[model samples]
Every structure is written in structure tokens, then in C-alpha cells.
Target: MSQGDERGYGDNDPGGRSDDAYSTLGGTRQTRTRMPRGTDDGEGYGRRPARNSRSLVMIVGVVVLLIAAIAFANQGGGDASGDAGEKKPDAAGAGPTAATGTKPVEGKNGTIASGFAHDQQGAQSAAANYAVALGSAEMFDKAKRDAILSATHDPAVVATLQTDMEKAYSAGFLKAVGLNEDGSTPTGLTFVSRTIPVGTKVTAEGVDSATVEVWCTGVVGMAGDGSTKPVTATWFTITEKLKWSGGDWKIESSSQAQGPTPVTGDNRASTADEIAGAVEGYGGFTYAR
Candidate 1:
């Protein structure tokens, strides 16, 4: 979809990301047998055992030392848990991966978390977490969507975005997504809209403004017996342009693109009921950098 004309919900065209939107604006073994080397051949010439005493003694000593070494190792006094060449990856060196020690936003503008740090790391964190909120199941609800937009976005864009989202999540769009006109799932089914961030990186940064891209994998659809819209997963990246406003980072605008995707997996897909249960049972995380 063209970024220019696609507002959040309008982006949910039948072929677009929200078709699945929860009204959220879219081995082999070889064995070898060795034959005995023909009995050291006739070259031994049936000679009487004229053993080399020195070599015999050396071999005996080496065997004895090997046995002793094995015994000593088995005694468990040394650090034999790992090989000398083995190394563990350092957690800190894993790059800007996963949540660091930094705490998540403590305050909430209603259900949406707020009060992110104002630095680069903080901006990335805010954007990542906000991406989760924007793509959540809650966004299908008007009030909750408004709260999320207000909490995470630049104040300047909130009103316009609200209007855009309402138009985007039209009644037809909701019905197409297995949702009622009010954006709730039909009885006996649960609508799932979840975005799980794989990682976040700041593509650009400034003191008060930064652009962060959150790579995400999400599940969207209705889950239950006889549900036509069984939940399915997709990959996409949300690029949030944020500004330091109200003492924290807030999204000025955001857009999404299809993916920095991976090859498909071979695992069997779950049944509709199984997916619905899983969606209900699993709780989401609040992302941090």
C-alpha cells in the first residue's frame, strides 16, 4: 500500500496487512569396517618374541600415565566442565539485544505506559514498546486506541491520527476481519491482534528527535471452532518517527512495511481452537532496549 494514502485502517485493505488485522491498522551414518592388517605378514617371519625392552617400558609408562590422568580428571577437582577452547558469548556484547537493565515506562496515560527516558536508548525503548501498543488487540476499541495514540504519539498528530484510524477501521473492515461492527469478535471466538518485536534499532537520532525501526512478528485473526479467520502470523517493520515531547519520547508519525522477513518454517500450523487458547493464555511483554 502507498504510505501517502494509507492511513492505519485503510492500510488494512483485503490484500493489505489488516486483512488479518484485529481491526488494528494493519541424518545419515556411514560405517566402515577395517580388516585386520594381515597379521603383520610373514615379515615377522615367525620370529620368537624379541621385544624391544626400552620401547616396551616406554609404552607401559605412557599407558600408566594416561590411566592416572583419566583417574585424576574423574576425581572432579579440576574445572573439566568445558573444553579449553570453548567460550560463552558475553551478554553485554550481544549488541543492543533484548531488554537491558533499564526499566520500562512507569507512568501510563490510562492503559498505555508513558514516561520513557529521553536518550537514544530511551527513544528506541519507547518506540519499541509503543509499537506493541499500537498493534495490540486493544487498538480495535475506540477509547483504547485513542489512549494508546495519545500516550505514545506526538500531541500534534493525535487528533488527525484518531480521525484517520476511525475511517480506517470501518464497519466493513471489521466484519471482514471476523469482528462485529463494534470491533468485538463474534461469540465463541476471540480476536487476536498481537505484535511481538524481534528487535529495535535507531535508524537516525538527534537530541530531541529520533527514528527507530521495530522489526516485529504478529498474529491476527479470530480463533475458535468453525472460525473462518483462524489466526495467522506475519512479519513487518514499524518505523516510528519520535520527538521528545512532554518530557519523553512520543511518536510523531509511524509507518509500516512488509518485512525484513525470514524463510518460512516447516512446523505444522495449529488448529483454530488451539490458536485461540494460546492467544488467551500467553501474556505479552513490555519491550525495552
Candidate 2:
């Protein structure tokens, strides 16, 4: 007999001979046979299980990779957060800059004042403004110079700095910047010796003292009519040793060095008239941390 007819019936075995053959092997006489529920011989049954397992594995792997990527992104791509993130104000004895709620006082001396926290920012601001005040044209004037010295310097250093500054701003130095021997304002020209602090930093801090470095750029020239070199800007760094005195930080000792400067710009220089007007119109800032 043919395999289909032998396994099931005489002629009309339409359910397929495979089902009949499976039933016959098990000694079943029934025309209909029950297939094994989880056999590998069915269409796509064997491959589909493995495929599903692989698909699940891939999905799990992708999820793990996404989690790892997000973690990496939060760490700023592994770059370190430096002094910027670490800065914090002092707890007790906080200064005006630290509180910000406290009003700022008119600086004790010239434009350079100090009521900053005894922390990094305060130390830096004090150093920078002190450098500006010390390097200013006002330091060449006798009365204003004395006032600045008295206000910002230690009592012991004031006298010494006064004498040293007098010699430093001598006749030859005045002549170089087109100023009179007594550091008077020249006719039709404004003497410029303004130091603008670029940034401030504290190298070291102690209970009674601190070491600060001030990065600064300054203009020192005679501006206006008949000026040879109208106004020239130069970059410098000032290192200050400061002491906490009666209610303020004062300069005990200080020194200066030139640049970290860059090459000159190609921009056209402003006319002496424009420069003078700009200088007069603009007011200086009361710098704080």
C-alpha cells in the first residue's frame, strides 16, 4: 500500500500522511493524531525559540549600553571640575561679598577697597584692586598717594612705601610719561595710570596672612592734544602678601612682574580725544568677589 493509504485510510487521507505515520508509530488506530506540543519538527518551531532568545539578549545588551552612556555623560565626559566648583564662602566672619546681603562700604582708601570674605575670591579681589591702586597715577600724587598708603597698607609699611614710591615716581619717571616732576596733570592732557584687574587668585591662606596673585592689565600714558604716546596698555602680574588688620585686609608687601601677554591686535588705535573722553566718561567699579 502507499504510505499515506497504509497509515490512515483507503483514499481520502487529506490531513497529511505525516500525522498518520506519527500516530501509527505510537500504535494509535484513530484517524486524527495529537502532535507533541513542543516538538522541533514543526514549521519554524526550532529556529523561532533560538531567535527569540537571541532577540531578548540583544535587547538586554542595548539597555545596558544605554545606561552606561548616560552615566558617562553626567560625569562631564570624565573631565575634572576644578576650583570653580570647589569654591565656598567662609561660615563665620563672612564678609560683604560672602553674604551679598550686606551692603558694600565706600572703600577705606581709593577705588581699591576690601570687605571680601577671607576665602579664595576675597583674597584674589583684594590683591587685584590693591595692585591697581598701587600701580595707579594717583600713587604719584603726594596727597592722594599718602591717603592710599594710610588706608590700604600696614602702619609699619606705610612710611617705608611712601618714601620708596616718592623715589620711584621721580623726575625721570615722570618725564618718560610726559608728566611734571611733581606728578601734576600736563596741559591739555590727562595722565592715565589705571590698572584693570583681569582676575584674582589665592595661592595660600593662613590665619593672619594670605598670599595672592593678581592678573592685571593697565594703561599708563598721557592722553589728549600734543601727546606722543597717547595711551598704551600693558599686562602684568602682582603678588601680594596680605595681613588681616583692624577690620580689613591690608598689604604688608607686594611685588610685580610683566606678562603672560599676547600679541598686539590689528584694530585701529582710538584718537587721543576719543580716548580721553572715554576715560573721563566711564566710572570705575567697586570690585568684590
Candidate 3:
């Protein structure tokens, strides 16, 4: 995996960075491998003499010694039991506890707006959650959509998005998904447009802004009888250029494209009733890194 350095600035909302636009959203491709069969090994290989048992033993002994030396060094300037020579039982075994407690402040980025810090992990988590929020069914409804846009987007972009989305979720689009003009349930059906993020990464980070990419999988369809389009999943990526604003992370600009998607599964499709029931039964999570 590629890694990069990240930094945070004091409470000041830096504007978006320049390299926000993506030339191509898709990632590099990897070559597929085939496993070797058991019979493919050289015929005479099994007859080779068992090699260097003594050398293996010596290597294991050295490794054990190295571990012991590290433990001893970690105990330095303190009791052998490791608590700065403290006699209390609870304090005697508290070295690891103290070390864990002293762990650095790894604040999350994007989440800082949601009360997270602007750290690498935080940035990734925020990207993932924001992707889910932006792709959710709520985005289809006027009120819920407005709430999400207001919460997650830069104030400047929300107005334009609101206008664009109003047209995008028009009556024709709703009808295509078996929903009413207003993006509501049609009688006995449950309209579902849920986005589940699979993974996230901080492609780049600046002092006051960051570029985050989220790989998301989602199901967008209606769950009801006579619906030709049953619940189906699609994979997509959302890349957001975020800036620190109003004590939180906000999307300065963002874009999305269809996946890095994998082939669809061959499992038997669930019944509409089953799908509706499952949707009602399950609850989604508030994700964090």
C-alpha cells in the first residue's frame, strides 16, 4: 500500500487545494495468479536430504535471545516487573497499560467536522462515511437530502448541488426505480438506496486540506411485488477534496465514477418480500476508522 505524511493546522479553515481534479478515478490493475498444483513439483525433490537441522536450531536460539534482549531493554530504568520499581501489584504490571495510554493523538480528518481529527486514518474514515451519506437513499428526498448536503458539503457547493439533485431525482428518475415522483414508497414497496463503503484511503494530505478516496458498494432498487428491478449492488468510487472549515471537514469539491467493480455473484436472487423485510430488520452503522 502507498503511504504519505499528514499534518494538521490550528483552528483555521483552509480552502481547497489545487490538485483536486482527477484525471482518472480508477486505480492500477493487478495481475491474477494461479496456484501451483501439488503434482507440479519436481519428481526427485522429496528425496533430498533433510538440510541443516543444527543451523535451524541455532537460528531459533538467536531469535529467542533477541526477544529476551528487547524485553530487558524495555524494562530499563525500572523494576524487572516494569513499573519504575513500584511495589503495588496493580502498578507493578502497568507498564503496557501506561504505554498504551501514552499513545499519540491520532485524530481523524474529515471526521473533525464530525468531531474527528485531521490525521491519516481520520481522513480515510471520514471519506468512507461521507461517501455512504452522499450515496444514501436520503439523498433522493428533498428534506433529508438537504440535511445531508448541508452537513457534509462546503457551504458554497450545497446550493448548486441542491439545484442539480432536484432535477436528477425528478419524476422520471423515480419512476425508473419504481418509486413515486417525490421519491417515496409506492404502496407496499420499500424504496432502498443504501451505500456501503468497502474501504477508503488518503491519496494525499496537506496542512489544511486532504484528498480522500472511498470505494463503495451499494444496492439501489425498490423492494416490492411486480418490481422488475430487484435489489442490485453496484461498486463505485467517490473522490473528495476536503478543506478544514468551521471546526470540521467539508467537501470543497467531489466527483464519482463507476468502479473498480468485481463480477456479480451467481447466488439466487432473494424474494421482494424477503428483501423488504431484511431492509427493515437491519440497521446501518456510524463508521469510524
Give the TM-scores of the predictions, in the order they appear: 0.67, 0.61, 0.60
Which 10-residue span in candidate 1 carries the lowest summed lDDT?
Answer: 23-32
Off by over 4 Å in 3: 1-113
lDDT for position 50 in model 1: 26
| Number of the predicted model whose lDDT against the real structure is largest | 1
- Per-residue CA lDDT of model 2 for 21-91, tens digit only, reads 10111000101112235534222101111123332332222222222222222222121112223332233
Error of 3 at 211 (Å): 0.8
Give the alpha carbon lDDT tens digit for every residue of 148-252 in model 1.
Answer: 777877777677666656665667656655678998878999887777667666655556777666666666555788765445555666666677897988876
Q: Would you give me the overall lDDT of model 1?
A: 0.54
Number of clashes recorded per candidate:
1, 0, 7
lDDT of 3 by residue, 98-210 (tens): 22222232443332226546654455556656666765667657888777767876786667656655554567655544667877878888876666666555555666667
RMSD of each: 27.9, 38.8, 22.3
Q: For each candidate in the order shown, give its overall lDDT on alpha carbons.
A: 0.54, 0.48, 0.48
Worst 10 residues of 2 by lDDT: 21-30
User: Which is better, 1 or 2, measured by TM-score?
Assistant: 1
Stretches off by above 4 angstroms in model 2 are: 1-107
